[model samples]
Target: MQDAKSTRITFLLFPGITQLDFTAPAQALSRMPGAELAGAAASLDPIATDSGFSILPTHDFASCPPADILCIPGGHGVADALGDDATIDFITQQAAGAQWVTSVCTGAFLLGRAGLLDGKRATTHWGYTHLLPLVGAEPTKARVVEDGKIVTCGGVTSGLDFALTLVARLKGDTVAQAIQLAIEYNPAPPFTSGHPDRAPAEVTLGLRTHVYDAAAARMAAALGATT
Candidate 1:
């Protein structure tokens, strides 16, 4: 069992990472008892979110200290981040040593690329989920899937739900539920435009092309002929 007095939680930050993917859950984790939150980036500098939010990093991958928990939040930059040798080296090292490692959305792509998700069941943003098999992962459609110590969450906003779920698993449902309630998470969608099936096919197609085309091109460049 980990000593409750001090447990570190490291979050890996790359350029263009999704804002909410790291922030919402990061806030929750930071508040947990005996929790210490640290953001790892390319360097101890500011990294811009996908939405252009700026975050100052705590440490770089090279100098990062070990922790009990680790997280990776993904976005358009995932293609670049995943293919970086330094980032992958840090993740492979830290994840191998940590008690638990998790990712939100396209962050799973990083894990998959690093070979961490190989032989593990995982999930990612549905758009790029098709590529998981290429990296030897057992992909699932579930919003969140846990296989051993590694946990993964599906697309974008699902990071919030995924992090909450993982919090329940780690800190107990009572604690997680308390946080959820405190956050007023009883969301009621005003429109029925949530799921792929519900949205008009045209809208979905447009969105797919608009959002994913660049990411797809980047992925092709990073992955090349290798999986």
Candidate 2:
């Protein structure tokens, strides 16, 4: 039996999630001491990822306990989730009492749809930041932005940084440092063209044309339903 004082961490699992967004944070949080972890979905069936991967939920929505931290990860399927009342309701209820509400990538969009990010400083994938206003959130360009108990991370790989920061917040600096060392989380990229501002004109144009255009269209529809 778990102690009542143990921190309950819940990650929303849905079809078409960007697996790394959830996995990176979940893995980091699992390393925290006395944190009870669960992946909750509408059902116990396996959840599919945008990358053609699958993960099983530990608990269904009805069986999920209140969460200290509620994480919603983003992916191509967020459009569908935005329109899902059950998923939105679950998030709204859980976030009401959660010590921290969070999301990675476009997962922030779901949080926004739940009406949790209104007036909060939040972020999502770089391509989707422009849509933040649709959900009443102030778009932030940082990799991670935390406004009170609401923490949102930008893009996919940023989840690792966000999780490590959360560990330091929940546990302590030492524990977080140890986990970082254990995971060898250092990065040394050969290219410096990750963000739109820093990327070459052609690369940014390509992304805006192929990626941002589609994402914006989906977000526009999602926001319409939520509003």
Candidate 3:
């Protein structure tokens, strides 16, 4: 009893994926009318997340159905996943027939590796935005950037914003609004510093020195080797 109007949304799941990048969007998009969500990986084995937990895929690359929306979520694993030919091939194949191809955080790098971001304006986590050009993308600063059928967003929690935005596009504002209300999507962070642009200089510098400096370098090296 499958609905003819069902919108199939497939997410690429990989080891060390940022769980929030996958789950936040899944929460919003799955609530859209007639929306079906599927997580696909290379195999059915449990995929580990950066959060010290694992997620089981609904389908493997060989058995997954073509999707209306194909999303790639990023994490520490993306650097390693970049070197996996099968993973890149899967993304290439899935994006070919998807009505909308998208990514969150460093997942944009995966899309870029698949030759999807060539000459396109894209974005990723701020630390890695500068590396987008290595993959033939013009890095645009925004939580979400839509260049044609390709949509890319910034790091982690931005997935929630990206999902609601896409839901509004696929269904309608009212439906998206209702879903937002249902999920209580309102955001009021205790801190004023979310992005580097808004964060205190010392705070941003500390984070970059501690985490993103090394992470971005690894990502850059990965992209450089691939390109």
lDDT of 1 by residue, 170-207 (tens): 77888878778877777688877566658788877888
Ranking of all predicted structures according to lDDT, beginning with the best and ending with the worst: 3, 2, 1
Kindly provide the TM-score of model 1 when superposed on the true structure, using C-alpha atoms.
0.92
lDDT tens string, model 2, 1-227? 12246889999999999999989888887877788899999999999997887999999999999999999998888998888999999999999999999999999989998888889999999888888999999997799999999999999889988988998887779888988888888888899898987889999999889888988788888789768
- The better-scoring model by lDDT among 2 and 3 is 3
For candidate 3, write residues 1-227 as lDDT tens digits: 12359999999999999999999999999888889899999999999999888999999999999999999999999999999999999999999999999999999999999999999999999989989999999999999999999999999999988998998888778888988999998899999899999999999999999999999999999988877
Distance from true location, Cα of 119 in model 2, Å: 1.0
lDDT of candidate 2 vs native?
Answer: 0.90
Candidate 3 lDDT score at position 208: 94
How well does candidate 3 score on lDDT at residue 131? 92
